[model samples]
Structures are given as C-alpha cells and as structure tokens.
Target: MTSRQRSAPASILQGVEALLRPLAVFRADLHRNPELSGQERRTAERLARWLGHAGCEVFTGVGGHGVVARLRNGEGPLVLLRAELDALPVREETGLSYASTVTAARPDGRVVPVAHACGHDIHMTCLAGTAELLAANRASWRGTVLLVGQPAEETLTGAAAMLDDGLYQRFGVPDVALAQHVAPLPAGVVAHAPPGEPLTAAGAELRIVIRGRGGHGGMPHLAVDPVVVAASVVLRLRAMAVQERRPGEHVVVTVGALHAGERANVIPDSAVLEAIVRAPSLAAVDRVVEVARRVVEDECLAARCPDPPEFTVVTRVPAGISDPVAAARVRRAHLAVFGAGRVVEVPQGQASEDFPLFGADGRVPTVYWYVGSVPPAVWDRAPGAGPLEKLHSLPAAHSPKFSPDPVATLRAGITALAAGALAWLGTGPLGNGEIMSFGSLP
Candidate 1:
C-alpha cells in the first residue's frame, strides 16, 4: 500500500466515529417510518436533504422515487455507491425503541405493515454518512462520488427503472460502481466473495395462475380444484431443489405467495402463485423455470382443467459478479481500514440482488460486498459455535426480527465505503496528513 493510503486509516475511523450519533438517529427515524417499493417519496426526500447538506449535487425522482447525488472533487475516477430506499411488507418485531409502527396499502388496497427488515435503512444511512465523510475529507481523495438511493429493490425492479430513466446518460457513466449489503454476521466485519464466484445469485420472479373448474364445497368430484393443483406444483418445485440440483450447484425455489378462494364454501376457478427461482447462473434459473412450468402444466392436465394456466415472467436479474481488479483494490482498502481479520472471504450467497444491472451488462466494473451487522455481544450469545451456525441462528434479512447493530454497522459501513472509494480515487494532497475536521453532522 502507498504511504498516503496507509496514513488514512486512523482518520477514516475517527471521522466515521464522529458521524455515528446523528447517523444512528437518521437510521432509526427511517426504521420507524419505512416505505414500501415505489412509495419512497418521504425516504427520497430525506436522503436528498442529507446528501445536499453534505455538499452533493442532489437529484431527486430520477427513476420512480430514485435519488442520485453527485460530488465532484476535481474528477479522477467516477465511483458510484448505491443504497436501497424501499422496505419490505413485514411488521417490525424487534421491539427496539424505534421499531416501525407504520402501515401502508398495497396496490391491491390490502394494508400491510412496513418495516426495514432488509437493512436498507442501514444502507442509506451508511451511504449518506460516507458522502458526508468524503465531502469532509475532500482533500484526501480526488474523484466524483455518485450516490444512488435506489427504490423498489425488494421487488428487484429499482435498478432497471433507474437505468431506463437514463441514470448513466444523465449523469456520466461511472468508472466503478460499488455497493454493499448488511448481513447478520458479527458487526464491524465485512465479507467479499472469492475471485470468479458470483457475489449473489441470478434469479427470476414469476407469477403463475393455475386454472380449474369452480363448484360448491359440498361437491367432491364435480370441480377440478386449482388449489390442489397449486399445492402439487409447490411440492414438485420444492423437490426440484434436490432432484435437479447438480453436484456443487446451488439453487433456491420458493413459493413466496399464494392466493385462492376467499370463502370456504366455494372452489376458486384459479389459484395465483407468486414464486421466485434463484440459481448461480441464468441458465440454471431458466432450467428451473422450465421445470416449474412443466410441473404446473402436468398438474393441470392431471386435474383435467378446462383452460391452460397463465405463466408470466415478471422480471429477471443477472447474477452480481464483481470485477476482479476492482474487487481486489476495494478488498485491499477494506483490509487497511478494518484490518485483515475483519475483512474475510465468503462463498457466493443464494440471496439475489439487482445491483448488477448498474454494470450495464458487463460494460462497467461493479464491486459488491457484505457488511456484518450483528453486534459483538449478540453474536457471542447466539446459539452457535461457528460463523455459519451463528449466521443461521440469527434473524436474517426479510425477517420481522431482523435488527442490525445500528452504531457498529453504520460506523463500519461508512468507513468501508469511504476507503473503497478512496482506493479508486487515489490519495490527494492531504491524504497522507493528519485527520481533517469533519465539521458537524446534519
């Protein structure tokens, strides 16, 4: 490492520490008032305010409720840092003082509790904090920092919406796009995928409608029950994970949502199933999707349905693959800031993300990593002896009880992001000098 880069660790930690209190408050406020996909108007406003306060040229409503902020400091390499602004339809059960009591209606007019169960609040807080830190220590780096507050990430459509709205054409294409996710691992640690392995899976979202004849509940053999067929399809799809999986290959097939008849006395004409299929590659996703289609068709045929089922491909996202060179550089920077022990290597995860779309299908370099969010004490007390066991024992993303260690997570995330940006931007005049005053948090 360059002497300039070596001298910045203490300042990075100190700057991040200074920003923790306000950032924690910001995160808690977001956690309490979470918004769902495509409904992040307030979230976008608050993020824009924070970015603008940090001296960034903030742009709001880029793509449906998306916000982009640019901080140009003489321009070396343009680094894009992204964070999700949307939350999940889960009721918060964390029991934290700032737990969400918010509820919103879905497009179908069904009300559901909303919460930041996936740690997007932490992501945005960290991104904003990083923007503040980089702006404060501008002399330590020379480049453009593009901060993106992407919406509808839970539905996996935000990245595409932003790109379609000309995220690159409006702002310049980035030299490197960087993003990180908060996981259930111990706080103050970061993990990256190994070389040549995908950081996250390639996945597809499908909406299937199984059709059948409708009849009264008293009739046993009169109506071809679509609900029964749907149940069969779900079982077969679950079996596909074990039956169709190849050696050393990972695939996840989930029947996330299902809806059928509203009354017990009536047999519905059709059953709607919302499912997700994820695999290490798109080809595998396709294979699993084909199997799912076949299973639905065969089950319908067995039930002698009057009409064919409707299978709609809602969306497909490619696997997140990091650029080798960019990954190595950021990994090095993370190690320098957090030390080698805190920055560890991890296997490719089954969870999927649309973050790879920022790469514009391999046209741009993208690097993504994981930031651990479980507090030290919590991790130590979890029912596990090893990292993997502890990870499984904790409340994972999308769970109602998933709560991150706000202070430790925000601190580590901000430092890691700042260091990664600096790794690409290169050190400036004051980079090797003493820590500069960060002014005050907004």
Candidate 2:
C-alpha cells in the first residue's frame, strides 16, 4: 500500500477532512485563553458547555477546576481519557498571529499573560473531538468512556485533587486510562511504547526553607544570617551529583529557585528553596527525599541555630508509570496511526507528570504518549534544542516566540486518541483478543 494510504485507523481518517476546520478553531480558541493551574474556572466552563452539546452527560466542578463527562453505550470495559486544564505563567514570547488574550493575577501577586505553551490546548481539543466522534457513533462500540479534563498539572495538583474529591470512587473507575502529550519532536509524528517498557511518569518537588536570624551586615560574628545557612544548603544540594546514593539508580535534584536577601549590605532572615526531582521508581524518590532532608537538618544543626520548621520536604509531582498491558494497546494505536517507522519508544524524561494519581487503584490503567510538536522553523534550523535551552525553557514552551504547528500537533493527537479509543473498544476488524493483551504479544 502507498504511504498516503498507510494512515491512521479508518475511524479517525473517515471524517478527518470534515474535522479539520472546527478542530483548528478549537485549538485557536484555547490558545487565546490559557488558564493557570488550580484556577481553571473559565476553562472548565468551556469544556462543560462543549461536552454538554456533544450528547454526553457532563458534570462540572470536579477537583477544583476538573470536568468529567460520561457517555454510556453498552456494557463493556470503562475507559478513562484525561486531558490537563492548566497553563504556564509565561508572558508570551512567541509573536504568533493568534497569541494568548488571557491574563490573570498569579498567586505571587504578579499579573502574567497565560499561553498554552505546554500544548494542553491540543489535549483538550483532542478530548473534545474524540468524545464527539465516539459519542456520535455510539452504536459502533460498547462500554462506558470516561472523559476527564483535569486541572493544575503545571502545579502537579490536579490529579491528586481529583482523586481527593473521589474521582475514582464516585466515577466507578475504568479498565484502562489513556492520555497523550505533545513533544518538541518532529510535527505530526507520534511516539509511544508498549507494555514492559517505559511509559508515562511520576515524581515530586522539594521546597526547602532555611531560616536564620538577621543582623547588621558588617557584624558577621553577631548576626546568624540565614543566607550563610542557605549557602551551605545550596552546596550540599549541588554536591548530590558527586555524592554516592543508591546503586545504579538515577535520582536528580535541581535547585531551580533560591531567594533570601535584600540590598547589598543587609542580610535576610530566611531563605526559600525550590527544586524538582525525577525518578522512575517510588523507592528511589523516597530515598532521595530522605537524604535531602538529612542534609538540611545536619546543616542547620552545624550552624548553631534552631532549625526552622519552614525547611520542608514537600512533594509536588508524583511518579507516573505507564501500565504494561495498557501501554501495549496505546502502542498498537500509535503504530496504526503514525505507522511503525514513525512510532518509537519515547526517551525517558526527567520531567514529572501527575497522571499516576488517577490509576492508583491499578484497575484504571493510564498510558500517556508524546506527540512531536517542535516548531517547524526550529526543527529545520537547529540540530535540536541543544544543551542550554530546552522545550520548557524561557524561549521554548513558555516563550512568546514558541509557536507550535497547531494543526499538525492537533491532528496527530486527535488521531492517536481516536484510534486508541477504537482499538481499546475492540471495534472494527483489528481482532478483539489480539487488540490489547497483557504481558507480551500473542
């Protein structure tokens, strides 16, 4: 068969020509109205209105800004589809024609313009389109499809909040859960792995606050400056690279933010610290968290000052792993859509995702895939994002100049989700037992 004919599942391509325009609009509309994490009130309203019209029984106000909709056709496995509903705090750097028109006051008392730098725009749009397609043809499938629009992924609080609100309990969970993210990879291409390999992710954030007494800058002997204690903390954190921890385990600790002083001469009373840690396993993460705390405690005691309670070992993001069996189904769907050559095992990333909280029961398996969204110009220009600047850097996703090939990205996401859903439902002639199997391929 020709390459043109070797496209996604027929269920996706059948009405592709018709979905182009509206899908484009959906992407643009979302791009113009990016909302911050945990504060996705307006974003929830838009999703609610759309899902309501899509012939699904929609529910709103779930887990802060979350929205859940249910479409029941016949008795089959319940599938959960999730899309995050949050935006980055970046001021638009990418001067695209259709940039963000939404701006809100941030928690830190700053009013920053919001943009869909993380491609959540396409995610929401894809969920909407997928729901519409599947719901419109309810007769072709069985079982209940649960579509969830989660909030605050940027803060890594959405999924946790949703579950805290009884998402799985009241919602009756699912046999398999699926979600996809856009990558800075080549546009329109999809990357997903099968069971027994890498998939999705989970991790945490560390906030360390070292408090000390502030006095005259000149009198170093008198003032128990917190900055000095903070300095030791920084060095210890930096030293994690050389310091031996677990055997053959990768635990990354990055001190992203440090603040504690005012004026050149005056010392501050406290220093606040924030860092992100990424680990493939829960045990490794716990080990690192304990070590970090021990370091902070030791430093505080050595400084001869009372240890501040503000020095915390808080966790923001949870480690999300792609279920072995569920991942295989996603892999088959991606292969069918992007073809074998285009489908690949996504590289293990240090970046963290909170999708793990949804499938905590181990019943509703969630597999989050990546779709390449590298700006066409950048993709052609540089060899890659390189060592210094990355996808979520100031000049990448959060930049005003970071314009995505929205159509290309959206098409791949929609096709992936739609094809994934169809294959999940055991629709058409893909073979029911052969479609999604556990452990290994038959």
User: Which structure among the candidates has the greatest TM-score?
Assistant: 1
lDDT of 1 by residue, 168-224 (tens): 999989999999999987798888888767989999999999988899989948998
Error of 2 at 285 (Å): 0.9
The CA-based lDDT of model 1 is what? 0.87
Candidate 2's error at 303, in angstroms?
3.1
Inter-residue clash pairs, candidate 1: none
True-structure lDDT of candidate 2 = 0.72
Off by over 4 Å in 2: 1-9, 101-103, 108-113, 216-221, 245-247, 261-265, 306-309, 316-318, 375-378, 384-401, 428-442
**Total clashing pairs for each candidate:** 0, 14
Query: What value does the lDDT take at residue 294 in candidate 2?
Result: 82
lDDT of 2 at 4: 25
- Please give the RMSD to the true structure for each candidate, in Å: 5.3, 5.2
Per-candidate local distance difference test:
0.87, 0.72
TM match of model 2 to true structure: 0.86
True-vs-predicted CA distance for residue 419, candidate 2, Å: 0.9
